[model samples]
Target: MRLLLVEDDTRLAEFLAQGLAEAGFVVDTVAEAGDAEAALDTVPYDLLILDLGLPDGDGMDLLARLRARGEMLPILVLTARGALADRVSGLNRGADDYVLKPCATEELVARAKALLRRPGGALGAVLILGNLRFDTLAMECAMENRPLDLSRRELAVLETLLRRAGRVVPKRVLEEKVYGFDDSVASNSIEVHISRLRRKLEAEGATVRVHTLRGIGYMLSEEK
Candidate 1:
């Protein structure tokens, strides 16, 4: 999943970014509300981890503005204020959930994943395609009843394709999904991963296939 983390605390932001990255999320962080707004203008993040205390403006105002603009993206508020009033206000301002500062890493990750499981977010809790079953929480895939071994990039490629199964997913979208904005990608990097994923699934006897449309993109579809 791709996410924009808006936090002013450098240490906390770094910690959460690392943890989220390890948990298979592409995260771009901004310390100010202006930068956050600009980032949103470009990248379509799956969720937002926003801090109420910003260097420029109150995060609450930004949250309210986003909601007012009909942005229904899942937003998890990270704040030092643990008061009931703060929590209530955050939710009232369209925040999906709240985690107090100094909260457990596991709890934060769990909350984010829970929000992503909501409708219109990322993948569901579990994804089932043909005889292949994937557990989003576990980040594991199974073919029939056997485990399907795959590298991280391969899994990312497959995940992107599965989300748009039976439809074309452009190469740029796939690249952005699999790689962070700062990460340098080689020419045909996504194609290489897709090729590897295709071989692995075929060798595992998966009932689905990834097809490339000439001069366009790729699609995931059931095998004929």
Candidate 2:
């Protein structure tokens, strides 16, 4: 899933970004509330992790603005304020969950999964494309009952495609989702990943296809 992490602390941002990426999320991070607001205007992220302490403006303002605009995207508030009143305020302001600072990475990931598991987020952790099935939680994919072992990056790419099955995901979108802001991605990095994924799927005897639209992007669909 794609996530936007709005945090002002550089160290915490880096740590969370790395951990979340390993946990199979495409994470984009912005340190200031302005950038966070701007990012939300452009990208449609699956979830958001917002820190109340921002350099530019209050994170609460950003959350209020998003809620006022009728954006129902899931948001998790991460902050140093652990008081009960603070948690209640955050929830009342539209945050789906609140995580206090010094929180365990595993706890954060678990909360994120629970948020996505809600109705209308995405189907269960298992993604389906034709006869191919992939379990996101287990990081397993199978074709006609045969198991396919895939690298972490390959798994990340495949999950992105499967999540949006039949939709043309733009190359830039895929890059932002997978690499986030920490990695310097080559121009052909996405294509290379897709190529590798296609080979792995085909090798497993799956008839599903990953179609490239040349200048457009890519889509996954059943072979005709």
Candidate 3:
């Protein structure tokens, strides 16, 4: 899943970004509310981790503005403000969840996954198609109950294809979800990932197929 983290503390941002990356999320971080807004305008982020104390403006205003504009993506507020009213206010202002500073990286990852499990979020506990079962929480995939060994990029490509099974997912959309701003992507990167994924599934005798449309995109569906 793609996530946008709005934080100002340099050390903390780096720490959180590392942790989130380990959990299979494509994280793009911005230190100021203005930059955050700009990133939001261009990227279709799956989640937003906002800090209430932004350098340019209040994160609360950004939250409210997103809701006013009908941006329904999940938002998790991470801040140092820990009080009854502060928590309540964050929730009332459209934050899906709130986490105080000094939080454990493990706890933050768990909470983020919980939000993703909710309706309209990008994740589910497990995604299943035919004999292929993907445990999203464990970040593992199996076919016919046998474990499937896949690299990080291959796993991400498989997940995206599985999520949009039976539909043509544009190549551009796949690129956005699998890569962050900091990562250098090659022109044929997405094609390479998908090609590897297709081979793996076919080799495993999977009942599903990954089809490529020339100059269009890719699709996954059960073989008839």
Candidate 4:
């Protein structure tokens, strides 16, 4: 899943970013509310982990602005303010969940899972296409109950496609979601990943196909 982490503390931000990435999430982190707000304007994230104590502005303002714009994106408030009043205020301001600072990584992950399982969030870790099943939590893909070995990037691409199954996901979106903003993506890099993923799925006897929509993008659908 893709997530935006808005925290100003450089040490905590780096630690969380690395930890979240290792936990099978693509995280883009910014140190200030302004950059976070700008990122929200462009990127489509599955969830937002926001810190109320931002350097430039209060994270609550950003959350309120997002809600005012009618964006129902799932947001989790992660901050040091653990008082009952602070938690109540955060939820009242549109946060889906609130986690106190110095929280366990596992607890944070659990909360994220709970939020994503909500009605409108992305599908749970398991993605199904015909007889094929890809489990994001396990980082494994199975075809008809037989496990198919896949590399990390291959799994990432397939996960992206399967999450938005039947919808055309543009190459740029895939690049951003998979590699994040820091990596230098080549012109045909996405194509390479897509091609590799296609071969793996075909070899595994998956009944779904990844279709390229020419100049538009790619989609995953059951093979006819």
The best candidate by lDDT is 3
> lDDT tens string, model 1, 1-224?
78999999889888998888888778888899999999888888889999999999999999999999988889999999899999999999899999998888788889999999887879587788888887877778899889989876677788888888899999988988888766789988988998889898999999999999877999999876
Q: Count the backbone clashes (under 3 Å) in each candidate.
A: 0, 0, 0, 0
Query: How does each model score on TM-score?
Result: 0.95, 0.89, 0.96, 0.92
lDDT (C-alpha, whole model) for all candidates:
0.88, 0.86, 0.92, 0.86
Q: In model 1, which range of ten residues has the least summed lDDT?
A: 151-160
Off by over 4 Å in 4: none
* Superposed Cα deviation of residue 155, candidate 2 (Å): 2.2
- Best TM-score among the predictions, by candidate number: 3
lDDT of model 1 at position 145: 81
Tell me the lDDT of model 3 at 57.
91
CA shift at 22, candidate 3, in angstroms? 0.8
lDDT by residue (tens digit), candidate 4, 123-218: 576788899888867678899889887766677788888888999999887887787766677899989988988897888788999999999999
Better of 3 and 4 by lDDT: 3
Considering only N, C-alpha and C atoms within 3 Å, which residue pairs clash in candidate 3? none
Q: How would you encode candidate 3's per-residue C-alpha lDDT over 167-221 as one tens digit per residue?
A: 9999998998899999999999999998888888999999999899989999989
Q: Give me the runs in candidate 2 sitting further than 4 Å from their true place.
A: none
